[model samples]
Target: MDTPPRVPGLGTFLDKNTGTPKPPTPQLVTVASRLLLLAAVVQVVASVIAVVYAASPARLDAIQLQIDAMTGSTPSLAMMRNLGILTVVISGIATITAYVLFALFLAKGRSWARVAAGVLALLTVMQLLGITLPEGLTTVAQIVLGAVAVGLCYLPGPNHFFATVKAARS
Candidate 1:
């Protein structure tokens, strides 16, 4: 039996039937992936801060007032606290999960991941724009990191990598 050809730097074997080699991850993709990971870390830290704030008695009282105003009935304190914690935790997990997944796929030269990362970065910018100024430094860092990651994804090296993969598959 013949040994399959290995793709250098990718640690992946060429396709058995078509013999197309997997493209090595471009430097741009590597940098973008690291940026995405950094963004995720920032999000996690923000989430922790949010959770701590939500756990505070003053914030809980504010949430209770809003709930009472909306429903005309006061929810139990425990229920309100649980809801706040759940919301922060779930949203944080989702945001981090998305960033990590995008980074992983983009590093693999997946074309769809590049599109997804672009759309996410655009949406994040739009959301930031809608918010008032004087946002936390963490928010600013997130925007900058996200922008850099999206920019790297569109750089020539990553673009060429995606094109090579698409051509090979075709």
Candidate 2:
């Protein structure tokens, strides 16, 4: 039996059970990937700033004084400083990893990408909650960015993309 040639104006409806047309990349997924990348970059910058803040003599002195006032006995300022530095390094690496994975998901259309992004966003929210800012600007920014990151994954475009991918896969 011979198959008729597809018409030029007609759209290609791929067989649900076979590999066919290239899957479309949704705008929301693209936005999500970019957001993750931006987050990673910001995290790196913030981490560097954190390390500088932790190592500054003035900051250390302030911390030491606070500790003395609280406990009435001096704690090792060096230990506190080292711990702060360690936190900065660890957080930066985590941010970078999340960014890389999210970007990969966008490029390769992986289903697990959103899961990783969600986890990272959750961690970021938790971290923001624990920090005390001198003003409300940082808190506001954190809330907005975190919301956008999570929101992107749930947007209609990405949701459709995932659905199509799932249907095609099965």
lDDT of candidate 2?
A: 0.67
Clashing pairs in 1: none
> Using TM-score as the measure, which candidate wins?
1
Candidates' TM-scores?
0.79, 0.67
Task: Estimate, for each residue in 1-170, the C-alpha lDDT of model 2 and write its tens digit.
Answer: 99889775332223344555547777777777777677666666666767787799987998788777875566688887888788878967877776676766644455566766776667666665557664323434544554686577777777778777666655
The count of residue-pair clashes in candidate 1 stands at 0
Predictions: Cα RMSD each: 6.0, 10.1
- List per-prediction Cα lDDT, in the order shown: 0.78, 0.67
Per-residue alpha-carbon lDDT of model 1 for 65-93, expressed as tens digits?
Answer: 87777855567878889888999999889
